[model samples]
Target chain A: MKILIIGAGGMVGRKLTVKLQGAGALNGQPITALTLADIFAPEVPQGGIKTTSVAADLSRDGAAEELLAERPDVIFHLAAIVSGEAEANFEKGYRINLDGTRLLFEAIRQAGQVEHYYPKLVFTSSIAVFGEPLPAVIPDTQVLTPLTSYGTQKAIGELLLADYSRRGVFDGIGIRLPTIAVRPGAPNKAASGFFSGIIREPLAGLEAILPVAETVRHWFASPRAAVGFLIHAAELNTATLGQRRSLSMPGLSATVGEQIEALERAAGLDAVALIRREPDAKIIEMVAGWPKDFDSQRATDLGFVGDSDIDEIIRIHIADELKGKIGRGAA
Target chain B: MKILIIGAGGMVGRKLTVKLQGAGALNGQPITALTLADIFAPEVPQGGIKTTSVAADLSRDGAAEELLAERPDVIFHLAAIVSGEAEANFEKGYRINLDGTRLLFEAIRQAGQVEHYYPKLVFTSSIAVFGEPLPAVIPDTQVLTPLTSYGTQKAIGELLLADYSRRGVFDGIGIRLPTIAVRPGAPNKAASGFFSGIIREPLAGLEAILPVAETVRHWFASPRAAVGFLIHAAELNTATLGQRRSLSMPGLSATVGEQIEALERAAGLDAVALIRREPDAKIIEMVAGWPKDFDSQRATDLGFVGDSDIDEIIRIHIADELKGKIGRGAA
Candidate 1:
């Protein structure tokens, strides 16, 4: 089937595109024609099939319609400014996150009415959709009460997806992802960056700063598991999703100290020692507001899985990010 | 303090406006001015309280901002096309219900930033936010998975209220009202009109048609209770609401059989027999989709009240609607 991957230059989008472009990609149904879109043109993948790279601001009135002229069978929407950036810039966030999404859906809905062109849309949401005063372990059924602009925007998107999907305008599924642990590449402004940075930097012999107390816990999933989630989401029959179209996904809940110990066990004590402890009030406030654990029974039953422990998570990161070349403080 | 009541010509809006005019209608402090707006201007209430009526489409740009220019201290937003109308005209539903609500919030948020003009907003939501396959009785904590366009609009409004409230941009509270029974009016297009029409028309010596099975149950409140819920929402402090700002109000659940019995016991056999049975498949399908019961623990704990029974509800209608002289079927 023809497919479009919006925001193909971002972290999740890049991985998902790579996974889809690999030889024998998408085990069952192969993607026939591929279009990769982002604010900036995406790096063209060379898997030998048809591909197009279109760079344009998605919030523009007819950008989505222009893309839909290709009539992709599947669209993976993995765009949006990150949580910190969105919270800080109100207009930009709402423009890109909320209006941009609506434009795409409206384009799809209108196109489908004219040309019978409904496509399976997989939107990547986040646990940020839940806010503070949460149950120690948030249940799959807790009402979405987002605290930040980013969270609120995501929650709004989820509502729109369910409504649009229900109206037969299109088929859509929103998977609320957990924090991707040991995220490779350089750290940015994300408050949750330390969650991955502490492990990633130390593994590469660079000392990493810990922003919050080691005892503070959070939910985590490997980037590999995230890719798996996208594939499963694309393949799952949405008829079983019923009315609750947005679902909490499964992941491991571990504290920073536990993550450190797992890193030490995997990469040895020298690598663990490269972790430095520091606290910023701003990051601490942001981390304190995030959900630490969830009772994600729905996704588990729906056949999504995550790393059993932090060790597996670290191993996956090393295998993916380190490229099998052992770092300075390796085991 | 200036207050605006949209949908003032509608049942709930009229009742709320009348009560506020009768009382001083202090929202946390004092009321200095009031504005009631709708598609048609509502009849002016007695008692000398400064009031203005505006008839303008909120779906248009700058309308909400223009309305907020007066800088009302509290805005009672009781506007919308109801269930049947919303479903009948899909475009109108999205345009008025979804886009109109968003534009109103944007106007409120913008006004709030100008010299700190945040106003207390009371939004009327509905139990239609819940669909079928309910768990015996739905709890206040149940996730919203609406099945219709009307439900989707209300759910989206609730989310926006929460998000806007969280920003400290405005103090907003959404009350999810049950179907108002003994609704004092001529039956329009609402399928659930039978709930009130069965008693309302029959008592007025006109034949009332029953469209669904006696076994089909639904939750309801009297028009008096609806006005009370709105007033209570305006009076209550939302600091206690935390992130879950929208609440499922307490209500009484009754089956059609129970309703007929209550009418018989209250208004005699003549009134009961004025009801004609004509099972409608369309209505049966529609009513079948509604929720029968709600846990309502939060609303109860928050001190909101509903009709004690169908007897008191009917008595309220007789005293309030017929001025206590039940001409023909006085039991």
Candidate 2:
């Protein structure tokens, strides 16, 4: 199987590359080659499979066509500007997120006219697609009323994926991933960054700030689970998806208090005590409009698995990022 | 008020032009100029209002920019390839429907950067945005699961409109029009043509074919009501809309049986007898998947109005089209 990963420079993309290299195969198909592309050239992973990394902008005129010159059997579309960046830079967001995705789809469609080719396209959507006035448990069939430009772009991508799949141009599946908990990176300035910082900083024997209330709830999954969703989505029979090609992946719903409790269980009371209460009204208001939980029965029935609880998510992070070593003392 | 109608040659566009010319103003602002554009130059309506007609394809490079050079105070974007045509010609559909709309928005945005300019962008959407497995009465928040490519394009347009409006690029109001009943002119080969044909052809002393069962239900609004929706959308204070700028207009939801009954009451049973039942499996299956009714309380509360019942709808069409004249018998 030949695979192409767009946006292979980002965190999830890098993890996905390593996972594919380790497995050496996908969906029981022997991997033959891999092509990775990003705005900056992605690193070619060391593997027996033939690997090629290219610096490409999919949004540019005729760029998608050039990238599709060596058509791959499976394509993972994960490239996007983060929510905060996209919100700040409106023109750049639409240029890359919206126009770029459309250009790729159009390129694939045009390629088929010259030679018939239909690849399994796996797209990463986000929970941001759903906004305020939401039900207690947002159903899989809930409408997309995104209040942000980033969410609007993702929602539009999902719509395009479904339409392109329905038209027999390509087999596409979109998975709306939950926020990655215990994110293995330094804390950023994003409003939701605190969700991960509160866990990661404490685990690394450092102090972390809690911007929102302890009762504030949100959905989560491990970075490992996120990669799992990509693999499963690629392997699944899209015929089951019918016209609605996008699925909300199952995730663990937990409050900030629950997350800290899990962090203490994973490390110790010393780690939990490192968390500092520094409330920010801006972050709280932004987080309040977000969906806290979802009835992702459709995704669960379709065989996409997630972590059992917040505790499980933290343990996976520790094992994967910390080499199973737990620091006991606070900084 | 200076006005620009992007699809002035279309049936609704032509009607809108005449209506605006007759009023000589919009929102109590006297019309200074009018610009009409389409693939072919629109007919210049006779009025004291200064008018310019241009042949323009909005999807082409620089076409939208050219249209916006004048910077009309209000833009009525009604251009689109009809559903059947769009379904048959996929590329053309996205080119004109999707790319065309985006270019227009982008042009407006760029124009603003040069000098401050924000027009009231009233976009015409359709009921096709909602599709199968629908509720008994689709609520305001029902998901957009479009069954057709045309519907998908319209849904995407709605998203763009909301985003652009939210960003303060333009003051956009999207009105999802119901199927226009008593569509003026020759019998076209569209599947939904029968809905208007059964009434239009029969009233004009000709036999009209009904390809679906009379029990089939769908939404409706007269051309006059459609124009009213546009004018109201233009005049209303958009601040109340918040982030959700697109609205499902209040429309009459009635079954074919109800429509026929209303026709019989208006022009006697002879007019109803002219209706020929020659069921086409293709059309029946297509019509079956459509939305039956909607709880459009949102639109109603917003002060947009439509015909109260099927009977009233037919009367409006007769009064508007036939000058209150009804043929006594069939040809």
Candidate 3:
């Protein structure tokens, strides 16, 4: 088997690369070659498989063609301009998120016209596709009414993915991933950053600001689970998916209080005490429009698994990022 | 008020142009200038308002920019490659439907950057955006799972329209029109053509094939009602639409049997007898996937109206196209 992972420099992409390297195979087929691509050349993982790293901007003309020249058996498209960046820069957002994705799909179709070539394409969508007036528990059949440009671009990508798959250009699947909690990095400017920061910072014995009230709830999956979704999507029988190529992946829904409770369970009261109650009204207003929970029935029925609760999500982060160790101060 | 109609040569477009001319005003603003653009130059309507007819293909570079140079106050975008053509000619469909629409929106945004200019954009979408596994009555919140390239394109357009409108680039509204029943002129190759053909051809004392069973139901609005929907959309206060800019227009849901009964009531049994019972398996399979009905609550609440029944649809066609007279044999 051959594999291509776009955005391989990102955290989830890097973890996915490592997982693939350790497994040495996918769907029971041995991995002979792997290509990791991003805006910057990604790190080459240590493995028996032949690995190549390429730096390419997909929005540029002919860039997608260059990447597809090798015709990898499975393509994992994980690259995107994050929500904040996309909303801040309109032209750049549409260029990178919308035009870039379409260009990639078009390149794949053009490549197939030369010869018989069809690869399994796994695309990463986002929960941002759902916006205000959301039901308490979003069902699989809810309409897409994205409030942000990033969400609109992802929705458009989902539509394109379905159409292209139906036309037999390639076998495609789109998985709408939840916000990754306990993200293994420093806090950023994202409005949803607090979801991870509150848990991640306290685990490291540092104080983190709680932007919203404890009652605020949102959907989440750990980085490990997100990677698992991409792999599962690639391995699944598309015949069952039918014409609807996109699906909301299974996730755990938790309130801020529940997340704090899980943190206390994991690292004792000291960790929980580290969270500062500094509410930001801007974030509160923004978070109000976000989806609180999802049924995710279709994804669960399809065998895609999620973290059991916030506790499991935190545990996964500790095991994966912290080598199963808490900060000395918190310990 | 200055008005621009992109598909001024088509049936509904022509009707809308005539209606605008007769009214001499929209939303209490006097009509000062009108521009009609299409693949071919549209006929200049006879009216007191100054009218310009231009031949242009929007997919080409500079075409949309040229159209937007004058910045018409109300822009009615009713242009698209019909479903059958879009399905058969893939590249042409995306080129004209998707790319063309995006370029136009981009042009409007660019114009706004140069000066203070924002137009009320009324986009004509289609029921084709809905597909199989449909509910008995598709509600306002039904997820778009388009089964055709055309529907995929329209769904993408709706997403773009909403995002752009939310960003203040344009005041936009997308109306998802049902199949226009009793469509004037000769029968065409569209899969849904028989819905109109059975009524149209028979009224003209000619045999029209009924390609599906009588029980097969579908949503509909007449050409006159479609024009009304467009005008109402143009004049509507879009604040109520919120961020969800697209709507399924009010349409009557009727089966072929009801249509025949309505025709018999209009022009006696002779008109109903002219309908031939020839079931084309290809069309039957195609019709099976279409939407049977729509709730259309949002559109109705917004004051968009439709023909009351199949009887009203036939009556409007006869009043509008047949000079208020039936064929000699039917009469």
Candidate 4:
């Protein structure tokens, strides 16, 4: 089986690639080759598999069609400008995220005209799609009222995927991913990074600033869980999902306070003590408008599972990342 | 007052232009000039003090900037392909409605850089934004889950308009127009036209097919009511609306059975007897997924009103259209 992963350079993309490479198979089918592409050249994986890394800007004309010409069995579309970058640079965001996605879908359709070369397209959406008046526990079926430009683009992409899938152009699944906590990287421009950074750094004994109020609750999933969702969605029978192809994937729900509590339990009180609570009003306002929880019954019914509590989430993070780095950078 | 009407070549567009010209004013403000634009050349209104008709495909680059150069006081953006057309021709629909709206808003923002030419942008959103599992009376805060590409485009437009308005780019109001009953002229490609055609034709003594069951219910507003909502939304105070700009407009709620009864009342049993029972499975399926009612409390508070019942809607049709052309084609 052949697989293509767009945005193979990003954190999730990197982790997902590693997981796919390690697993060596998807849905019991052996992976023969992997085509990894990004705006920048991805760091070539060290594995002994026939992995091809291509530096390609997928937004440009015919680029996606050129990539899809290889006829990969699965395509994981993870390429996107993060929220802060997308918000700050308006035109670039739309050009990359919205227009780029459209071009790719159209290219896939065009490519399919000659022969039957439809691949399972797994797209990563976000919680940014939900704006204010978000229920305490957001139902999977809640209307997408995206406040941010990135959110709007993602929501629009989701709609396009559904409509395209409905038309039988391709088999598609859009997963509205939660805030991936304990993200294993230096922070980029994504607005939700602060959520992960605080927990991640404190446990690593680095002093991390808490930009928002501690009471602010958010749905979360470890990097591992997100990869699991991508793999699951890629192989799952789309016939069950029908035209409403996108789903809010189930995730662990925890407030900042709970996150801190988990940090204390996993690492130590000393690690938690390294956390500084200097609330920035701007970040606070942005965070306040976000949803607290999600009733992702659809994803759950489809057999997607998440952490039961924040402690388990913390445990997973320590095990997967941090090299079991606990207790003020000492695991 | 200067007013710019986008999508002025459409059904409601023609009616609105004539009405606005006749009124010679909007919100007690005297009309100085009216700019009507669409992809097609709209019929220029005869009565406005100064009228400019521009034929421009708005989806293209720089088109909005050109339109905004005139700097009108208010704008009525009514341009959109109907649901059926959008669903069928997906790319064209998104290109015109979704991308076009964004470009327009961006143009307004760029123009505002010079002298703040932020017109009161009154967008004609639709009830198609709401799909199944809806309450009998959809509230102001109901989630938008459009089944068609057209509805998705409208919902996304509403979001962009609201977000832009909140950012102080322009004062925007999105009126979720119910199915406009009694559409004038020859039958067009609108799928929902049967709602109006069934009763109108039967009352005119022409045999009309009932594609759906008699129990089919949908929210409705006459073209007059639709115009009223547009005018009211344009004139209403922004202070009352605050940051949340889009709203569900008030309209009559009735089933097909009630529509027939109203036809019977207005045109008598003889005229109503022209109705024929013929079911089109495609149309019935389409109608089945439509919203039944709308809880338009916000629109009511904002001073937008609708006709009392289906009889009133039928009566308006008789007065505005038929013009005692009733029984001209009666069976």
Candidate 5:
């Protein structure tokens, strides 16, 4: 099987590449070739498959078309500007997230003009698509009323994915991933970043700030689970999806206190004590608008899986990113 | 108040334009100038306000920007290709319905760069935005999953309108109009034309074909009600809309049997006999996917009204289109 992974330089993309390398195949088919693309070229992974890495900005004219020239069997479109950056720069967000996705879809359609080439396109949408005045638990049928530019862009992408799939341009599946917990990276300025930082930093025997109340809840999935979702989405039966090509993926809903308790279970009191409560009203206000939990019936029924709870999410991070080891300060 | 009406040549547009002209002002403000634009130039109505008529295609590059050059205080963006035409021609649909709307909003935003100009933009969306596997009574929070390309375009327009409105580029309100019953014009090939035709033809003492089962249900509003929605949307306190700028306008839901019964009550059995039952499987399948009813709480609370029932809808047609006259065979 041939594969193309866009935004392959990002954390998830790198992890996905490593996972794919370890598997040596997808959907029981050998990975003969791989094309990895991003704004910054990704490093070639340790794999026997023939790999081509290129730096390309998809929002640029003809960039998407050029990327589709090879026409891989499966396409993983993970490229997008982060929420904070997108909110900061409106035009840049729409250009990269909205226009870029459209261009890619158009390019794929145009490529099939001479011959039938319908690749399985897996798109990464976000839970940001749901916003304020939200239900306590958003159902699969909840309307998308994104309040931020980034959310709006992702919602548009989801709509386009469904339409293009319906038109037979490509077999598309959009997975609305929850906030990835225990993110294996340095803490960022994003309001939601604290969800992961509070857990990740403490586990590393480092101090972390908790911006919101301990009772504040959010939907989460581990990076390992996210990669699994990507693979499953690519392999799932498209016929069952019908008209709704995009779906909210299943996730574990947990409060900040639950997350801390989970960290304590894995790393004991020493790691939990590193967390400091430093309330920031701005972050709290922003996070409050986010969807707390979801009844992602479709994704769950379709065989997609996520971590069971906050404890499982924390364990996955340690297993995957920390080599099954804890910090020296662990109790 | 300077007002601009795009698609002024269409039936609803003409009605709205004439209504505005008759009102002499909007929101108690005097109409100083009116700009009417469409592919075919609309005739200027007899009014004291200065009227400019132009034949302009909004999809054409620079057309939207040029229209905004005048900087009208109020804009009624009612331009669109019909469903059948859009379904048959994919490129035309996206270009006219989606790209045209985007270009118009972008032009308005860019204009604000030089000088602050936020016009009250009343965008005419359609019930086509909702599609198959629909709820018995679609609520205000129903997810937009349009089965047709036309519906997809309109749904996309709603998203853009909300985003643009949120950014303070334009004070925009998108009203998702139900299928306008008793459309006063020549019979067209549109799938939904028969809904209007059955009433229009029988009222005019002509034979009309009922292409679906008597039990076929759909949401509807009169052309007059549609015009009212535009005016009300234009004059509404937009601050109340908050983040959700687009709304599902209130409409009466009635089956074909209910419509025929209402017709029989207004006119005699002779007028009802003018209706010929000739089932078209294609139209039946198409109509089956349409929304049956809606719990348009947002629109109702916002003061956008529609006919109370099928009987009231027929009365609207009589008072507005027929000048309160009925056929000689009336009961």
Candidate 6:
């Protein structure tokens, strides 16, 4: 099975690449070749499988067509402008997030017109699709009224995915991934970054600012789980999805308090104490509008799994990123 | 106030234009000018107000920019490829419905960048945004899982409207109009045309085919009421909409049997007898997936009204289109 992973330079994409290399196969078929494409050429993973990396701006005319020329059997589309950048620069956001995705879909359809080619398309959507006035536990059927431009783009992508899939252009599936917690990287400018930073920094014996109240809850999944979702989506019998191509992937819901509690349980009081209480009103206000939890029944029923709790999420991070050892100060 | 109607040649657009002419004002401001644009040059309405009719395909380059050069204060975007056409020709549908709408919004944003220009954009969405597995009474919060390309385009438009509105690019409102019953003029090829045909053709002393069973209920509003919704949307203090700009507009929910019964009451058994039970399997299957009813609480609270029942719907058509007279066969 040949595969194409767009946005393969990102952390989740890199991790997914490694996982695929380790498995050597997907959907019970051997991984013959892999093409990794992103804004900057993605790093080619060390594997027996043939790998090619290309740097392409998909929104540019003919870029998507060039990528689809080889006709990869499964395509995982995860590239998107982050929420902050999209909100700050409207044109760029729509260009990359919305136009880019549409161009890719159009490319696939055009390719099919020349030859009978239909591939499995797994698109990564986001919970940002749901806006304020959200119910405590958002059902799978929640209306998509994204407050941010990024969210709007993702919602539009979901619509396009469904329509294209229905028309038999591609066997498409959109998985609305929850925020990845304990993200295996340094802190970033995203308002949701604190969710990961509080754990990642503290585990490294560095002080991490807690931007919101402990009572504030949000949905989460480890990066490992997110990659799993992409793979699972690709392998699924799409006939079961019917007309609605998107599914809100199952997630572990936890508050800052619960996350801290899990940290204490794993790495002792030293790690918990490393979390500095410097609340930022801006993040608090923004986080207030974010989805707290979801009843992702459809994804769960379809066999998509999530971390059992905050403890399991942290454990996975340690085993994967920290190599099963605590930082010196925390230890 | 300057007003622009993008689909002034269509039935609802024409009605809205006439209504504006009758009122001579909107939001209590005196009408200064009107611009009517469509695929073909719309026939200029007879009115004291200055009017410009333009032939334009909005999806083409520079078309939207040309339309926005004057920056009309209120823009009613009522243009779209109907469902049947959109389904048959995917490229045309996306090009016209999706790309055209986006280009218009982009033009408005560009104009605002040059100088302050935030128009009240009243977009006409459709009940097609909601698909099968629908509730008997679809709530205001129903998920937009459009089953057709047209619905997908409209749903995408709603997302864009909300996001752009939230960003202060434009004061936008998307009204999801129900099936417009008793649609004036000859019957068209739309799957939902039978809903109007049973009432319209019979009132004209012509036989009309009922392609679906009488038990099949559906949401509706008259063409007059649809125009009213547009005007009301244009005048609304959109602050009440918050992050959610799109609304399921208030509409009457009635079955085929109820419609025929109302026809009998309005024009006796002779009019009801003109309805023929000729169920086309294709139309029946298509109609089965349509939204039946709506709990349009938000639209109602926002003061958007609809015809009270099938009787009022038929009455409005007679008063508006038939010169308040039943056909000779029924009279």
The lDDT leader among the candidates is: 3
The digit string of per-residue lDDT tens for model 5 on B104-176 reads 9988988998998999999999999898888899998989999888998998898999989888999999999
Per residue, candidate 1 scores C-alpha lDDT tens digits across A104-180 of 99999889888787789999899999888788898877778788889988988998899899888888999999999
Error of 4 at B330 (Å): 10
* Alpha-carbon RMSD, each predicted model: 2.1, 2.0, 1.3, 2.2, 1.9, 1.3
- In angstroms, give how far residue A152 of model 4 lies from its true place: 1.3
lDDT of each: 0.86, 0.90, 0.94, 0.84, 0.90, 0.92
Q: A3, model 6: CA deviation in Å?
A: 0.5
- Model 4 clash count equals 6
lDDT of 4 by residue, A165-264 (tens): 8677889999999988878766555667778887788777788888888888998998888988999999899988866788998998888988988888
Which candidate achieves the best DockQ against the true structure? 3
lDDT: worst 10-residue window of model 5 chain B: B322-331
Candidate 2 residues A1-331, lDDT tens each? 9999999998899999999999999999988988899999999878888889989898899988888888889999999988999999998898899989999999999998889899999999999998987998998788898889999999999999989988999999999999988777778877789999988888888889998999999999899999999999999998888788997999889999999888888888999999999999998899999999999999999999999998889888888888887674322
Chain A of model 3 scored by TM-score: 0.98
In candidate 2 the C-alpha lDDT for residue B214 amounts to 88
Taking chain B only, the TM-score of every model is 0.97, 0.97, 0.98, 0.96, 0.97, 0.98
Order of models, best lDDT first: 3, 6, 2, 5, 1, 4
| Deviation from native of the Cα of residue B305 in model 5, angstroms | 1.4
lDDT, candidate 3, A191-291, per-residue tens: 99999999999898888999899999999999999999999999999999988899999999999999999999999999999999998999999999999
TM-score (all chains, Cα) for each model: 0.96, 0.96, 0.99, 0.95, 0.97, 0.99
Candidate 2 RMSD to the correct structure: 2.0
Clashing pairs in 4: A204-A329, A205-A329, A326-A330, A326-A331, B205-B330, B205-B331
* Pairs clashing within candidate 6: none
- Candidate 2 pairs with clashing backbones: B1-B30
lDDT of 3 by residue, B39-130 (tens): 99999878888999999899999999999878899999999999999999999999999999999999999999999999999999999999
What does DockQ give for each predicted structure? 0.75, 0.77, 0.93, 0.50, 0.78, 0.92
Candidate 3: which stretches are off by over 4 Å? Answer: A328-331, B328-331
- 2 or 3, which is superior by DockQ? 3
